[model samples]
Target: MLQIEKKKCFVELGKFLNQFSLEENSKNETVLHNDLFFDSFVDLIHLSQSHNGWFTPEQVYHSVQSWAKALQEENLNQWLSNYDFSKVQPKTVGLILAGNIPLVGFHDFLSVLISGHKVLVKTSSNDQHLIKFLAQYLIAVNSEIENFITFTDGKLENFDAVIATGSNNTARYFEFYFKDKPSIIRKNRNSVAVLTGEERREDLVQLGEDIFRYFGLGCRNVSKLFVPKDYDFQPFFQAIYEYKDVIFYEKYSNNYDYNKAVFLMSNFKLLDNEFLTLKEDTSYASPISSVFYEFYENIEDLRKQLENDAEQIQCVVSKNAIPKSIPFGKTQQPELWDYADNVDTLEFLLQI
Candidate 1:
């Protein structure tokens, strides 16, 4: 299939996704293959949580809407405009997906096919259904796509290159295993926020979205905070109170109760807001239902520190407090070009 054909299929898939949302899921008869796919996709979205406890209907709908916005013709064109794929030869690219958040590996899947390569995907056990279902929709829209996509139940084979996402330990295993293949192997990384004393209440509230979205499971979620020395926590707490209902989710509440007890038993001082706990720590990866914070004495020194530790950080949320920092609540809505781990996935695929 031509590159334009691939783009058209994805655009149709996006339109199919655009019909469903948390508040409503009315079917639109105008979408292609609606009679076959529209109601089934809704059922899958509702059943997503049963497949994986974290993939609630709200989270799944959010993921779907984000993609619906991204896969428009203009967005795809703008993203692909800078890259040349005319000389590309088709090859099988193996994708090892991460299920930390809904559709976490869709970008890699999209990249391979859009670049005129066949994809052999090993879906993360935690996220087996959603992508496969979408692949069926894509094939329905354009039968040619069936030649380009495949999902593996066992070990990956007959692939020229690979893209894998996993923990720091699994990354090492991927490096040794795919040493000869052109690859992008991702590892554990966390996002952080830099807060001066000048943030507005609205900024901090949006910052709560960065913290609690996906229950803080995604690499892009802000798990740590860099606050100025003696910065008051009262306002931050007040602003984030809007997300207190997150605790009503049974799994999150269990984490909150358990982690809080563990901290209290260890005699560590905690700043608690009933639903979430704040602790003084120097780590980037914080536990769920909790955020780790560190006090910095100087902005310049902290900036240099983050620069040196860039490999360990996914994003920095701030109000121009740091260079190239993402806005407060926008971490989860990454653009197509916002390559994970700063690795250019398309460039890697084109080379292979």
Candidate 2:
């Protein structure tokens, strides 16, 4: 398929996805293949949590909604305009996706096909269904797109380049295994927020969205916070009260209970609001149901610290305390150009 054809296919898929939301599922008769896909897609959204406990309907729909907005013609054109595809030579690219969040690897899939490369995907068992369902929808939109995509249960092979997301330990194995091929190997990276203590309740409430979305499993989720030395927890806790309902989910509730117990037994200090716990720690990667925080003496010094640790950080959320910080609660809602690991996937694919 031509590049324009591929873009059009995704745009159509986006429209199909736009109909689904946690609030309701409304079918648009104008969307192609709705007669074949609309109802089944809604069933899939409802079934996602049963398949993967963390893939709650709200989270899945949020991801779906994000992509629906992302694949608009204008967004696609704006994103692709930066790269020249005239010199591109098509190649088969293998993708080993991480299923941390719902459709977490879809962006990589989209990047491969949108860049005019054949994709060999090994879907993480945790996220096996959703991406495949979308791929099927894309094929239904244009049968030619079928030639550009493949999913395998065995192993990835015969691909010129690779893009893999995994933990730091697995990254070591991936680096050794794909040493001969051009690759983008992603390791564990966490996002953090720099709190200035002047944030409005609304700003912090939105920040709660960043923290609680996807049950705090995504790399873009704000798992850590940087606060001033004398920062008080009263305002922060009160601001995040809106998300207290998150504790009602069994999986999340269980995690809160377990992690809190571990922290208590270890004699670590904690600020608790029943649903979430705030721990003072220097680590960027926090466990589920909790966010790690550390005090900073100076904003300038903290900016220097974060920049030096950029590899371990995915995004820095702040109003303006740190440089290039993502606004209060926008960490999870990344633009098309916001590449994971800050590594340009399209650039890697096009080079292959």
Candidate 3:
């Protein structure tokens, strides 16, 4: 229905969103997204709970509004208005979302929506509710969006492009099926922090957020740390231990227990934080039960290793001096300029 010109629609959505204050203590009695077009998003938080983690409805509401604000930016609007949608006409995209973190697939979802393409979402069952809620909201904004979106239980086929997120094992399957087409197939890559031995205790405390958010399941969550061997691990450990209350969650406890038992059975050395178990490993993807860390004696060596391992890394975080291009906080709070998997989503959409 909305073949072109959505200026009024976005304006109305922004006005509707203003009705709910997204501050920490807003009562949850009102419609979250507010517009009749997006009322279906009201149950998203309930859906996140049904999955694995305990995401409050408030968190969902805030994240959605955050996305709305970005989309409503003047420069973003200018870009969308000038783009020739016909360049990517009728693109059929198959997307495999990662559930390691809350709303990780949102960027891809927006890439399709703003590019005017049809999306076939294969949501991670672990975080399926978030996407459904977001889709419902978009559809409410413009009822025509409903026809542009669809859920598929079958194998992806006849798609012009595909985007998949999975572990190394599943990536093989994705590559086998979608390699022939233009696609972005993400394999396991962990975010890491390179401490230059001069990091303040306070920064390490914030680094805890990088490690603990989403229970360390997201790709952006740092599963590995590269610290100087001479650097004392005590302050770093102490900073993270302050948040020992993270273990209060049953989900985190379950992982802690399961990983502890397995580590003992396999004879692995582990450092425990009551909530997180840290170990030394070369790998980046850590289990919900344990995080992996490695020590390096020389900053030069660490830099060299990271340079060699660049292709295998998603991000590098450090308060210490480093290249400006590397992002911090494990999470890719990327700008519109940050192309996913280093590929320009807009360009890819246009090509399709």
- Give residue 327's lDDT in candidate 2 (0 to 100): 92
Score candidate 3 by TM-score against the native: 0.84
Q: For residues 269-319, could you state the per-residue lDDT of candidate 2 as single tens digits?
A: 998999999999989999999999999988889999998999999999998
What value does the lDDT take at residue 193 in candidate 2? 92
Candidate 1, residues 176-269: lDDT per residue as tens digits? 9999998899999999999998999999999999999899999999999999989999999999999999999998999999999999999999
TM-score of each: 0.99, 0.99, 0.84
Clashes of each: 0, 0, 2
Model 3 lDDT-worst window of ten: 24-33
Number of residue pairs clashing in candidate 2, backbone atoms closer than 3 angstroms, sequence gap of 3 or more or interchain: 0
| Residue-wise C-alpha lDDT for candidate 3, range 128-201, written one tens digit per residue | 77667556765666777788788776777667899898989999998998878988888877788877778778
